[model samples]
Target: MMPIDRERSDADMNSLKRTKLAYSILSIVLIVIGIYLIIRPQTAMLTVCRVLGVVLMFYGIIRLLGYFSHDMYQLAFQFDLAMGIFSLVAGCIFLFRTEWIAELIPAFIGVIVLIDAVFKIQTSLDAKRFGISKWWLILILAVIAGALGAMLLVIPLKVVEFVMVLIGINLVIDGVLNFWVVHDTVRMIDSL
Candidate 1:
């Protein structure tokens, strides 16, 4: 009984609805993680920083060995040699002075996150200029982001662990939401 144009419009609405739901779920997860990081940053900071250092050291060592060895893989060897040595040095630094280095981790991450949020808010505002309905959402998000940034800059050592935990939570949430989209889309297509 429905007109062809009405059917098309309905289909478009369904698609948009699905997309928005998925995005909202992912955003909620990320916000939860951000909250966690705000609460418990020190432990997260140390663990992440140490792991990163070790990985770097491993790559550096491989690079250095490859250059001196007979394998001569050329590009890979050179890359490995450089990375291996640098990683080893970095790993040592992290291993020995985790306490000192960990303090910087939270602040560094906060700055990066704050910058990213600002960019996102700018984009959201731009969208609003095109007559989008959620201009207030961007303002709220920006305020939260700015507050978190200030916290990080003021308290690095105390914040790293919390930040790490929060970031981990966000990633897991994002991954789950993305996986859910694949599920919902499959279900929708099956129904059709």
Candidate 2:
């Protein structure tokens, strides 16, 4: 390879490593937050919203970075650009307009999760075609997460505790599924 190409390749590899690390951190955070919500459904809504806002923003930035990372397969982050932008916008609204968006938070989050699940479904299919063995797991998790997200959309805001628990379940599933997809599908190998 030319010197310039080698340098670029090195940079891409570094970016990919960082993106993978970010995804790992994000996944753990999601799982922890999900457990917290599950354990304390009665926690103040404002607190939950603030925390979620920060998490969503972080997730958005990570997804954007992942989208640009030079993974060999390019399957994991194909839909991340759009998802990242949507997450950033939602995070901003949740953070800046907390009071106004409080009651609608569940539905908004539901939309995000649903969209992610849909994209993961496509990713899983692509992975299957690419001969990945764990594709079925991704598809199953995405389906379950999608169902939970849809439930969040239709849930009456009157049932605050139930909504919180449901959201927690969805988050846990999404986190695990995303972690798996990123770990399994994103490859940095220069030679196929």
Candidate 3:
């Protein structure tokens, strides 16, 4: 019984180690790809759009067929079905005419960032209601984010370079954060 318990414990430890290793690898890969997308926005966007479109189209078709065949089709779920079709159409447009669609990528990202920054800034202001000076950093970062977003709109040419640099900075930050988390988790697991 003692030997059996020891073997089980060893196996459990090995499994936990494997899981942590996998998570670390996955996090690193995601961060790398994110950085790559920012560096080569046009190409990455084109590829992602095309792939997404194809997947959405297929999903739509599958859902549409199920909707007709199944008696339990809900109206709310139909919205998802419609969205899939829309995604497919949008993807097809980008896949076929990437040059025109490519322009939309930067603009869309810019608008998203602008909205995000505005929200962050607002949250920071709201925090000021509590009289917190730390919120000032959030406000400053928000302004920087909005400025970077505006740069994309005001000067499209430089946006690519800015995006690349921003991505590099983000990746470094994310990598460091993830590394710390991974290290802590490993330590905790080992302590167990």
Over 1-192, each residue of candidate 2 has an lDDT whose tens digit, in order, gives 599988998999999999999999999899889988899999888888989999999999999999999988889989989988988888888899998888997898788889999999999999999998999999999999999999999999899999999888988998999899999999887644
Native-vs-model 2 lDDT? 0.90
Candidate 1 lDDT over residue span 1-192, tens digit each: 569977866675465445435444544544555455546555355666666456445434433543444221122122334444554776677767887867665565455446545644554555455454555555455556656665656663544355566454433333333233222222232244
Q: What RMSD value applies to candidate 2? A: 1.2
TM for every model, in the order presented, reads 0.41, 0.97, 0.41
lDDT of each: 0.48, 0.90, 0.49
Count of steric clashes across candidates, in order: 27, 0, 0
Candidate 1: 10-residue stretch with minimal lDDT: 70-79
For candidate 3, the 10 contiguous residues with the lowest summed lDDT are: 69-78
From the highest lDDT down, the ranking of the candidates is 2, 3, 1
Q: Superposing all C-alpha atoms, what RMSD in Å does each candidate have to the true structure? A: 15.3, 1.2, 12.5
Highest-lDDT candidate = 2
Cα lDDT, model 3, residue 55: 41
Off by over 4 Å in 1: 1-44, 50-101, 156-192
- Please give the TM-score that candidate 2 achieves against the real structure: 0.97
| Cα lDDT for residue 158, candidate 2 | 95
